[model samples]
Target: MSTFFHIHHDGDAHGPEAQRIHTELIEPVMRDLEERGRLDRFYVLNFSGPRPFVRLIVEPRESHGSNLAREVLASLRSRARELDFLGEHDIQPQGKVA
Candidate 1:
């Protein structure tokens, strides 16, 4: 199944910690998904405001297995918490509509 995952940050998206998390945690999992041919679509969007952050778009590959969502979420969540982002930030999946 495919879903939209959002990570809203209240801090600096280009900060040192954010960069580390992306490099160490998020990127690896994304690369895995790509290698598995289970990554359908991806994007990085930015919004400017008093609180600025980036939104990432990930679409599961059409022929993916049942566990693709779980795998992706697990990888992102682990690093988000490590960066102290679970509270001020948010990570949730938007179910794909049939």
Candidate 2:
């Protein structure tokens, strides 16, 4: 099984706080996961019109699964929460892909 973390950015995505989180929290974990072959995929989506928002999709390798990814994601979320940039987040189970 795979695991996906859905992150929603409530504030300005390009703002200083967001940048800090990206640089210090997100990017480092991403690099570590990539080097370990534990990163399945990552994507960013934007919603248009009023209340524009951005969404982050992160999938971790099936072998490592949610157990491992959750720890890293939780850290990232904690930082974001402290910065007040996080809207919400959720983890969903992803079936293995061929």
Candidate 3:
């Protein structure tokens, strides 16, 4: 199973802004976590709808336990706030999945 975190943004999913967010914001954080060996695998999905969103599917390192997902989510949220992006988006834990 894996845990998913949905980062709902109030903007176009396929816009340059979304690409910037992924490259400048999300990627850096995910890369850092990966370097720290905190996660087994992670994926980012861009979705367009009434409320466009970026979904993060994370598989935590078994040695790190389930809390790793929550930790990563918190880190992303914190980084977003630091980068002044949280005001336009929200990160929510979508729970576990098979």
Predicted model with the maximum TM-score = 3
Q: Which runs in model 1 stand beyond 4 Å of their true positions?
A: 13-21, 65-67, 82-89, 96-98
* Each model's backbone clash number: 0, 0, 0
Instruction: Identify the runs in model 3 with alpha carbons over 4 angstroms from their true place.
Output: 96-98
lDDT-based ranking, best first? 3, 1, 2
The residue-level lDDT of candidate 3 at 18 comes to 76
CA displacement after TM-score superposition, residue 80 of candidate 3 (Å): 0.7
* Per-residue accuracy of model 1 over 1-98 as CA lDDT, tens digit each: 44666665566667754555456656777887898788876665554466555556677777664667766777678766676655423665557422
Candidate 2 per-residue lDDT over residues 10-89, each given as its tens digit: 44656654455456656766777778887777665444433434444566787776466565556666666665655434
Give the residue spans of candidate 2 off by over 4 A: 1-11, 45-54, 77-98
Which TM-score value belongs to model 3? 0.86
Which residue window of length 10 is worst by lDDT in model 3? 89-98
lDDT of 3 by residue, 1-98 (tens): 57888888878998876786688777888788789988788888999999888888888788875578767777887888888876534878785522
Using lDDT as the measure, name the better of candidate 1 and candidate 3. 3
Clashing pairs in 3: none
Better of 1 and 2 by TM-score: 1
Alpha-carbon local distance difference test for all models:
0.63, 0.55, 0.78
What lDDT is obtained when candidate 1 is compared to the true structure? 0.63
